[model samples]
Target: MFYDVRRIESYSLKISIENGRVEKVKFDESRGKAFRVLKNGFWGYFVGDVDDREGIYLAEKNAIGKGDVNVLNVSSGGKFTLKPKEDFRDVSVEEKVEFLRDVEKNLKGDKIVSTSVTYFENVRRFSYYDSNGNEVFYEIPRIGLIVSAVAKDRTLQFYSKRIMKPAGLEALKGAYDIANEVVDVVTKLVNANAPPSGDMNVVADSSLAGVFIHEAFGHAVEGDHVLQGASVLANKLGQKVADESVNIYDDPTLREFGFYPFDDEGVKAEKRTIVENGILKDFLHSRETALKFNSKAGNSRAEGLKFPIVRMSNTYLDRGQYKFDELLEIAKDGVYLVGSRGGETNPATGYFQFNAQYGYLIEGGELTEMIRDVSLSGYTLEILKNIKIGCELEFDPGFCGKVDQLVPVSDGSPHILIKALVGGS
Candidate 1:
């Protein structure tokens, strides 16, 4: 039998600027502890604000029944912390709001009708102890800025830009640049033509590619999904699943938004290579899932007191050999999709559909004209097998949600060229 306890503290601030004025400001703080015990093959979990010993006793008492389970006989402990060069806690709320107001001031264009800027920061600290003589502590801070611009000509057009990172208040320094880019993008989108509808070669920028790999393929490889037969890759291990030029990895040790030294289960975080040179490799796993599959453990995560589950950290397509320009030349005539709005996927069926925030028509190996309301859809495996990976990998930071639990994550890829179904207005 084993017992574990976790203490968590989080602080966040959000400021919204609309139409060159401060619209809203909010701040939040929370702290709590969660206790868990594994006994007789049954897991018991409880959350409370009581003495640690009492909580552990209650959790152990609740752990009843028996089943087949095995945990690695490993013991580790550590303390890790990242101190922001410019700590957000040291900055006053008024100053942060003022900074956002200045950013909104730059999001102005003759055709621009409305602009909204949002600034957010989060700091989280965690401490953990388990019956196996493992102890750990860590703290991380994250910040993000988003700018949305709306333009009105004959019709209304909208565009947005986001800059998020696992850093301190310093990350907000780019808000002005992001705001300007959003203004320019929305202004051009006001006159952009509708994309053509049909199957065609497509070039995805790093951001779109990141979202593509994360949504279209990443979720399908989670260990829990594989165990439940909910993933297409369930029985495809050691088989070819992608082009020879493609490789994919999920690494929690990367200093990105999803970075973590140790998972909720006190397992040391490490990289998992899901695909290597077109071959299916492994699935992301929790301790239990790893034990079930006779694999290694690392990726267990939870939302506060919720039970830990297999989750992704920094998942990305490994960089290939072709340069961005080379990929464009290879694509010749295709749609060049830029950023992602959002998307949906059926991991069980390997089907995905993602909407591009905006894009451009590629003609004669050059970007010809901007296009709007474009969507890309295809079978995930098919796209992977047909992809032409590129050099110059880049990452984009965001939050990934699974089973109603949201966790910070980063996804990345270089430019990729592939053939898929394209839908337009």
Candidate 2:
């Protein structure tokens, strides 16, 4: 028999300004606990706002059914408290509003008809203790700023930029540059031409390529998906999956938005190599999945009071030897896509489709004109094999959704050259 208890206490704030007007400023607090028990090859789970002993009793009582669920035994214990250089509470709401205004001012333009800015800061305190002598706790802050604008001429176009990190107020130091970038993209988008159709060579910026790998490939490597036979990579471990030049990693230790000292399961975090030079190496795993697969455990994570599940933290394609100019040169006559608006991917089928926020047409190894409504789609494995990676990797932070739970994550890569179908949507 085994048991564990997890609890989370959090405080968060959100402030937003719209079209040069202060719109909403809100604060929130939440706390919850979860209990889990394993007995007779069955597991029981309960989440609530109850005391430790009562929670454990409820969980054990709920473990009345029979199932073949077992968790790996690992001993891990630690405590981490990240002290922000400047505490978020030290900044007044008025000061935050003014700071947001400073960023919004840069979004002004004749073609720009709408603008908005939102700031978020949250601190979560997690505590965990389990039967295997695993115990851990952490207090970390997550901060983000979002700036966006919409431009209209003969057509409507939208652009947005986000700066998020595991730091405190200091992360907003780049507010000026972020707002300027939002304005620049929206400005060009107003006069940009529609994207060309059909399959063609393509160059992807770090942000776009990051999303590609995270959505198309990351989910497919979660151990649960492999066990369920829902991923195309279910049986491809130790086999070649990408070109020898391609290497991918997911690390929770990075100071990006998804930084976590220890996963919810009390596993000490480490960088996990999913693909190493074309070879499928490992999958993200929760304790149960790890035991079944006879693999190591650590990728398990949970939102407040939710069931622990396999998740990616800061996933990225490791940088390669080529430079940005080299990728453009290799793509000679293709679209250079920058940023990602949104998209869809089927991990079971190894296919994906994504909409670029905007792109520029590449003519004769050089950028020609900005293009709007840009999209790229292809088979994930095919693109992975053909990827010509660039030097200087970077990351884009956002939330990832799985089974109705949203967790912070960052996807990143250097520029890349590949071939795929481009469309205007």
lDDT, each prediction: 0.88, 0.92
Ten contiguous residues minimizing lDDT sum, candidate 1: 67-76
Q: What is the per-residue lDDT of model 1 for residues 47-79, given as tens digits with 9 covering 90 to 100? A: 988899999888888887787665655566899
Runs off by more than 4 Å, candidate 1: 64-66
lDDT of 2: 0.92
Q: What is the lDDT of residue 204 in candidate 1?
A: 94
TM-score of each model, in listed order? 0.97, 0.99
lDDT, model 2, position 253: 96
- The predictions' CA RMSDs to the true structure, in order, are 1.4, 0.9
Deviation from native of the Cα of residue 306 in model 1, angstroms = 2.1
Q: Output the lDDT of residue 146, model 2.
A: 93
Winner by TM-score: 2
* lDDT digits (tens) for residues 1-425 of candidate 2: 89999999999999999999988999999999999999888988889899899999999999999888999999899899998888888989999898899889999989999999999999999999998888999999999999999999978998999999998888888999989988888987888999999999999999999999999999999999889888989989999999999999999999998899999898999999999999999999999999988888999887778888999999999999999888888888989999998999999999899999999999989999999999999999999988899999999999999988889999989999999999986
